[model samples]
Target: MESVRTCVGCRARASRSSLLRVVAIDSALIPDERAAIPGRGAWVHPTLECAETAIRRRAFVRALRVSGSPDAQTLIDHLQRNG
Candidate 1:
């Protein structure tokens, strides 16, 4: 069976392959396309809407259990280029 995860933006459950896994690295949000990163990861849909929502709502900080604001610009650029 496919693993399931909840999107931090929309708060919806989806198949692991259907969502993107993001990890926090020293206040930077990094997208883990392979989902092989070793750390606490937050799942979000690979869409601008979901990404923006998560950013606007400061979901990444909470989901990743980070101490400060994480730079999501890389994630935005990534989604724009590959989304």
Candidate 2:
């Protein structure tokens, strides 16, 4: 069976493949397309609304256990392009 994860933005449970895995690198949110990046990861739907919600709520920092605010523009840009 496929794994399941919760979207930190909408707080909805979904199949792991249906959500995008994001990781923090140097205090920046980076998309983990392969979900192979080592470290804690936060999952979110690959939609601008979900991505923005996650950023607005600072979910990445809390989920990734990172200090301060991690730049979310990269994730936003990524979603925008691929959304």
Candidate 3:
């Protein structure tokens, strides 16, 4: 059986292996490619639109229960850098 996680943006359930896992660290958003980060994590589809929605809606903050927000550019940068 595949592990399933809910997308913070669209609330869609997806296989954990298929979704991109993002973790908040040092007050910044970091991509957890290994999904081994020991902190609050938010899931999103591996698409720019989903990432944009998550940022625009503050879904990451809500899912992570964080008070402050991370810069969306940082997230896009990370995605670009990693991809």
Candidate 4:
């Protein structure tokens, strides 16, 4: 069976390999290309809407336990560039 992860935006459970994993690094959002980042990570659908919703709602901050330095736009841009 495939590993599963929950999308922080929609709260939908999906295959871990199917969702995109994003991690905050140096106050920037970077794609977890290998899904091996040590810090907290957030999962989202590869679609624009889900990415936008996650940013608009600040889901990453909550899920990742980040505070005062969450870069929502950077994350959105990363998702757009990578999606």
**Each candidate's clash count:** 0, 0, 0, 0
For residues 18-66, write the lDDT of model 3, one tens digit per residue.
Answer: 7899887766777787889898899987777788888889998888777
lDDT of each: 0.93, 0.94, 0.82, 0.78
As a whole number from 0 to 100, the lDDT of residue 15 in candidate 4 is 97
Q: Model 4 over residues 1-83: C-alpha lDDT tens digits?
A: 89899887788999998898888877666667678989888898876788778877878777777775566666667667877
Work out the TM-score per prediction: 0.96, 0.96, 0.86, 0.81
- Look at candidate 3 and tell me the lDDT of residue 52: 82
**Candidates sorted by TM-score, descending order?**
2, 1, 3, 4
Model 4 CA lDDT for position 6:
88
Q: What is the lDDT of candidate 3?
A: 0.82
Off by over 4 Å in 3: 81-83
Which parts of model 2 are misplaced by more than 4 Å?
none
Residue lDDT tens for model 2, 2-70? 999999999999999999999999999999999999999999999999888988998888999999989
Off by over 4 Å in 1: none
lDDT of candidate 1 vs native? 0.93
Candidate 1 weakest ten by summed lDDT: 67-76
At residue 27, candidate 1 shows an lDDT of 84
Q: TM-score for model 3? A: 0.86
